[model samples]
Target: MSLTIAVTGMNARADNPGPGLAVARCLKESALAPRVIGFGYEALDPALYHRGFVDRGYLLPYPSHGEDALLARLTELHEREHFDVLIPCLDAEMQSFARLAPTLTGMGIRTFIPNSHQLALRSKDRLPELAAATGISSPRTQAVYQANFFHTCEAQGWRYPLMVKGLFYDAKLAYNADEAVAIFHRIAGEWGVPILAQSWILGEEINLAGVGDGLGGLAGAVMMKKRALTDKGKGWAGISIHDDELLFAAKRFCEVTKWRGGLELEMLRDEQGNLHLIEINPRFPAWIYLSAGVGCNLPDLLVRLALGEQLLPTPPTPAGVLFIRYAEEAIVSLADFENITVLGETLRFGALA
Candidate 1:
């Protein structure tokens, strides 16, 4: 019998999923061809998401907007569905999965994740610290809590044009020491805690995605650039170009971390052209399909690894492969804007092929 797997993710709502959609699609096309279930609040259309692949998709209730309701639901689902592999995605889910690994294993489901301590380093505040430890050039970074910490940042001579960020996600950038401190204090006051601080890099933004063996080895990988960013400043509205330097750097970074599962490294090529480390997203990235276009099918590799299969060794990939996201609108007056006809079609072919 084929390995039956279940991919866990939130459904799309006002917050359209960037890479999550791609991740689900990849799983749908895999050798096992596992069922994809997006567990979320009543915001996502499971039917639409499952249109092509899932044997049957489901929607589960959460305890409010938070995922505190997960452990029980996941436990119940595992018992009922009898899925061989369970992949919980998103930072929130990653956190829960790390905590629930032992429990899930006891319940007969295999999970992929890092320990909680390692996961913290993937958090926004600690990402740069991990980079520095790995000998990767990260933006100059610090964590500050109150006004005092902000004042110290300025007095200590932190570089100007800095990024002040949340522990879970990105925040705003502040120019000059004073402005940065003020923003920090304002944000901190609102939250009652410190946010992350980092020197901004003025250069090309590149992101690499891959999967790991969890035993200190690579499984699958791909590298791509941020050709064009969406309005939310999330990921590629369009992308083209791939680089080996990026692939190498990404692989080496994961090796250094001893990362055991899916990973995405967001790095910047600074003015001097150094690939300075940004953050490590140990989850599927927004444009992972772009990576598949070049031969690194992360989701497939993830499934096989989860199934305990041997992997084919991958050599350093070449540069110059290109992909661009196209959007379709009306040439003349029309009520319908068919994006599927433009960007989605080519991306789907490139991703599946």
Candidate 2:
């Protein structure tokens, strides 16, 4: 009940909210009721000012700044806050945190995260291989570095109306090479990667949020079907569903990967009832707090795991739970902005150090 934990991905923008705010909200409801520290890259990340969810906020250098700078900033924050655990909620930052796990532990920061290899096995570029290993169907995917690849890809049996993707975010359906080239450059420019060209599948979307105990055991699983979507195709409203087939696929995925921590499996079900693996996200989705609402508190369970506690199998969450995304303003003082922007940190109850 006395643990202080830090969580990242605080940018709770309406169009594309991050998961940290939801994770913090879930933690606040736990019996432990730990002190929540919001860790963010941008100073104005809305969760920083959402005092109801976050007790304090600290600005950290972006993941692109490399581990040294990130470690230095975290070390300083730890010196002042003495947080007991950290739950990173952004996909792009997971690699850096996974690689720095041991170093963070050495500095008395406990984090339960999959290793880099576990993360890599389920990355977008490696989805095909993951499908093969788990005996699941996956759309053909090719990782491309240059737009020119689009010009010659059809020769390799790639078809039109393909999905153009970035390493971290952004997905567009390109009906022709020109569209493919445009999207390729746009995603590459923003996310910086070998752009992905994946065969587009026609189907309804299904999602599963599952927590792994780092030993090929699934702590809990919740399946949902989207009832509404944002313009960008993110789930805007969804309802929990009980699908044994989908749960089997998710269980197999965790078993095959020995995946640790929370992950979301995005899948598509074709008209003929064939299920295809779409994408594997390493961290919890922005809708994660829905797990808490459904009687499975994954973030709190993750904290217990990070603290070396053994876990019992989580019961199946009751189906029919629904969530609709909405927006609200977080009132903040000019002083709160100045402290985080200029000093890179701020305390809500009172100034600390």
Q: What is the per-residue lDDT of model 1 for residues 14-98, given as tens digits with 9 covering 90 to 100? A: 2335355566767776565666554433323322234454443444544343545677677676676787777665665677678
Residue 331's lDDT in candidate 2: 69
Runs of candidate 2 with Cα error greater than 4 angstroms are 350-353
- Model 2, span 1-353: residue lDDT tens: 49999999999988788999999999999987999999988987988777788899899999889999999999999999999899999999999999999999998899989999999999999999999999999999989998998999989999898999998998999999999999998898899979999999999889998788888887788889989888888888999988888899988988998889989999999999899999999988998888888989889888888888977888888999999989898766777778888998765563322
Best by lDDT: 2
Count clashing residue pairs per candidate: 1, 0
Query: Each model's RMSD to truth, in Å?
Result: 7.3, 1.8
Worst 10 residues of 2 by lDDT: 344-353
Which pairs in model 2 have colliding backbones?
none
